[model samples]
Every structure is written in C-alpha cells, then in structure tokens.
Target: MSFSLSTTVVSPEGEQLYTFEYAALVTQTSIALVQVYVELGVIEAIGSMLHPREIARIAQIQRLRQDLGLNLAGAAMVLDMAAEIAQLRAQLKAHQSRPQNELF
Candidate 1:
C-alpha cells in the first residue's frame, strides 16, 4: 500500500488536520471486512485488518450473545474477518508458488 499527504490545515487552537489519500492492491474480502466494521460503528472509516485479539474478542462476543439467545453484530464481524483471512491465505499460497526470482 502507498499513501500521499495532500495538505495540512491548522486550527486556531494549533491543532493540525492532515488530509491524505491511499492506494492499495488488496483482496476482495479485505474490502468486505472494512464494510462490516463500518456498518457496526466499530470504526470511523474502512481501513486495514483488525488485530488478532480484536478478532477473537468479536468471536467471543458472538458466542456469548448466541448463548444468551440474543442477536448481535459480532457474528457478522467474525464472518467478515474469517473471509478476509481465507482470502489472504489464498493470496499467500499463490504468491509462494511463483518462482523466487519472479518476486520483487
């Protein structure tokens, strides 16, 4: 992934707001997971993968909710993360199969 800063604006209180844009060659599931997080209000914006502990926590919450016979958003998040992990694993396998010299 690569990112570029566009500009920075300073507030009267001396706070800085930096504007930027980023581009990345990413998998489909990565995008899906981001969308899920956004819908759940877990993040302000769609971005990269959540930490492993975060994933585990979400999964645990989902289980607990199910045990209580309650519906929640955590299960959806877990599915999204699982899909992303599978997609990434596939990409890794594909990359590994290519000749070493072909990688750069």
Candidate 2:
C-alpha cells in the first residue's frame, strides 16, 4: 500500500489492481467522476478492478481539464497524442541506435 510516486501495489501474481473507490481516493476525485470516466471510455476497468496505470491516467486527465481548462474529450485526445508521440520517439531512438549498413 505504498503511495510513492513510482510505486504501485501488486498482488502475489504480479498483477496490480485496485477498486474503483480506491482509484477515486488515489486520484483525490469523486467516485461519480470515476464512473463518468469509465462510462465515457476515458479510463477502463475490468469488472470492479482498475490497473494503477488507469488511476494515473485519471489524475492526468483531471489535471489537464482543471489546470489547462480543456474539456474531457480534449484532454483524452491530448493524452492519446502524447502517448503516441512517446512511442514514436522511442521507436526513432531505437532506429537511431541500430548500426547502419555499408552502402559503399
């Protein structure tokens, strides 16, 4: 049950799962808001369990909405774009790290 910035609780099977209520608590938001996010497909849940990453995503969404004055859909789209950019950057880095073939 560590609340460290980089720590998340995991089960014996190495799966990290938390209830919707716990996710709301962790994000300092309301359970109704959590439910709205789920209903809006902003954050997904498996049954009543949510991955820690989803909780973090919820916090990010809230920050974007409150701090940046973005709407929910805009926030979600921004997050999706950010994730895509990160993935593309990682791929570009990996390609740059590979050895070039001799052309001459």
Candidate 3:
C-alpha cells in the first residue's frame, strides 16, 4: 500500500529521466488469495462499465474541465455505477463464501 518515487536526471544533452522506483517490504503474512481474487473481480466489474475509448475520452474531458472550471453530468453516472459495482461485489463475495453442500 505504501510506495516511493525517485527521479534521476542524467546529462541535459542526453536527457534521461527516470521516475518511480518502487520497493515493498516482503512479508509472509497469511493473507487469503481468495480475498485478492474478490478484489480483482470488483475492480473488473467497475472497469467493464467504460469502454477503452470512453475511458480515454473521459480522462481528457476531466482534465480539460478541471483546467477550465467546468462541470458535467458524469459524476451522477459514476455514482450510479459505483453503487451497482458495490452491490455486485457484495453478492460475489457472499456467493464465494457460501457452503456448497447445504441440505435443503
């Protein structure tokens, strides 16, 4: 969860710029891989709401709007999508943890 960024500048003529050397402390914690899988599933659900081209366009529009002090209706759409994503994630986790051989 923690990260660091480092930049190295070489010669101005050569113009070599290096940024973000990340290193995390390796810990052998007993974290469940299923939890990681569930998190990734939630992320994928959110990601699927936007096409690649729409993502690019949204990024550009957000940047331009921020620079020019403009507002749009995307916030509502994002909120709705977030709600749906949360519901789906909860259902997925519940289903994953359910007992398979329950008697009726």
Candidate 4:
C-alpha cells in the first residue's frame, strides 16, 4: 500500500506520463496482479512496469471483479471487447470524417 510519490515515467510512445508506483497503490492492487493482467493481454506494460492507461484499466478490472463478482477471465474478456469497440468507434469516426469522394 506504499508508493514512491516522485517516480514518474513516460510511455514508450512518449505520449503518456504517470507515477507508476502511485497508480498501483491508488488502485489498491499489487504489481503481481498488474503483471497477470499484462499476460492476459488486458493491459500492456513497459518492461516490468505498467503504463498509466494500463494502471487505470487494472483499477477498472478490480472494480469489476469486486462489484460485479466477475472472475479474472471474465474481466479480461470484458476489457478485450471494450478495447475492440473503442477501436471500431475510432475507425468509424475517421471514416465518417473523410470526404464522400474518398469512399471509392
């Protein structure tokens, strides 16, 4: 339940930043659970650490498991389907924003 407050890291793409340890602490989860989520492909990590987004996702999974009594596999499947839906929504938005002539 302890974390280093000053530890900050940038994602590999360098687009996201966060206090890696803080995220894990705030979520009340363990680094080991985070690693498990990575293996489940519910989240991706940078080496042994997790990205900010992945940390948030882990928190979501925790809530899902605690509130809804979902198993780890169910939480993983939900995360996967949610990610797929987000990707599809982004693609649909990009497609809609293009000029009508580009449809050809």
Candidate 5:
C-alpha cells in the first residue's frame, strides 16, 4: 500500500528483492491472484520476483478485468498491444531526434 523510490528487502536466503507479499500489497491484490497473473503471462516475474512495473501492469490487468469486464485473454492482448505501441513510440521518438541523413 506504500510506494518508495528504492526500498530493498532482505530475504532469509540472503537475497535482496521485493517479496511477493510486498508485490501483492503494492498491487492491492492477493498473492494467489498475483501468481495467477504470472501463470497467465499477463505479467512476468524476474527470477522469483516481480518488477515494480510488472506489479503496476498486474493492477492494470485487474482493473481491465473487473471494471471493464474484459476476459483474461482480452486483457492480456490489450496489455501486449499497449507495450508494443509504447516501444514503437519510443523508437519513433528516437529516430525523430536523430539526424536526417542517419535515417537513410
């Protein structure tokens, strides 16, 4: 439920990462729901931890599913397409900022 710029958590195994419990709190969902999102490929886990962005995406997916009444597949497709469009926009912006001659 709280957000921090850089919060580090130490696991009993001595690894530094965000716990699934924290991710669930941050996403305002349950651990099992987060796992379901991971299993469905609606979000990804880096090793065994979810990135902050992935957590946010999971929240977005939850909203799409609950508020908009989108099915799991539909929400996944929307998220995927949104990611692709964001990448394409970034590439276009980078290309636009380059020299005209370099575009050839």
Candidate 6:
C-alpha cells in the first residue's frame, strides 16, 4: 500500500492556503505570472501562501482581464470598486431594515 502526499496547506480555521507554484497550477497560470501578480499587488499573499479568498480574487482578476481586455491593474481596480459597492449595498440594506425611529 502506498500513500500519496498532498501539498495543500490549511490554517487552524480550516482555510486553505496555496503556494505560488500550486496556486499557479490551480489558477491555470504560470509561476512567473503569479509572482508578478503578487509583486504588483494584484494578489495579496501572506508571505508565500495565498488564502482561498485570494484564489477567488485571482480568478476574478483573470476573468476581468481576459473577458474585458483589461490590464492587471485595471482588473484589480475594478474588483476593488465592485467590493466597495457590495459593502455599501449591504450597509444600505441593513440600515433600511431598521425601524423608522432609527433613521434619525
């Protein structure tokens, strides 16, 4: 019997972290690109590992760059704006949910 080794890393909180090499593989990009993304702040990494949420951000950036023909910086900017808008919408919803007495 043989056991296969896995390279995946998990935090105590159960969040998955990926190395640059593994993230590149998972994201279907090259290691160089991943490193560059990290350098350019397109993707934020905690040292050499990236959180699962960051993986989704990488995918979103890729989608924006590929589909909209935007550059990495532009893609990152768009995503940031989208996140801010989402946060504002959630805040608005929560505020609206409060009773009229709280609106003052």
TM-score result, candidate 3:
0.31
Model 6 lDDT on a 0 to 1 scale: 0.83
Per-residue accuracy of model 5 over 14-44 as CA lDDT, tens digit each? 7566656677887688888888877877787
The reply for model 6, stretches above 4 Å from the true place, is 1-4
Model 3 misplacement above 4 A? 1-71
lDDT of the candidates, in the order given: 0.49, 0.85, 0.38, 0.75, 0.78, 0.83
Positional deviation of residue 8's Cα in model 6 after best superposition, in angstroms:
2.0
Per-residue lDDT for 1-104 in model 6, tens only?
Answer: 22224546787788887777777777777778888888988888987888877878888888898999999889999999999999999999999999999789
For residues 1-104, what per-residue lDDT tens digits would candidate 3 score against the true structure?
44344333444455443322210112221123212322543112121122233333334444444665555445335544766999999999988787887523
TM-score, every prediction: 0.35, 0.82, 0.31, 0.75, 0.74, 0.85
Top TM-score model: 6
Q: How many clashing pairs in candidate 5?
A: 0
Weakest lDDT window of 10 consecutive positions for candidate 2: 1-10
Please give me the total number of clashing residue pairs in predicted model 3.
Answer: 0
The per-residue C-alpha lDDT of model 5 at residue 12 equals: 64
Instruction: Name the top lDDT candidate.
Output: 2
Q: Over the stretch 1-104, how does candidate 1's per-residue lDDT look in tens digits?
A: 34345334454556543321211112212445445544776444313333333444444544546676545565556555877999999999999999999998
Task: Residues 1-38, candidate 2: write the lDDT tens digits.
Answer: 33335334566678988877788777999889999999
| Model 4 per-residue lDDT at 76 | 73
Give the Å error, residue 49, model 1.
30
Candidate 1 backbone collisions, by pair: none
Ranking by TM-score: 6, 2, 4, 5, 1, 3
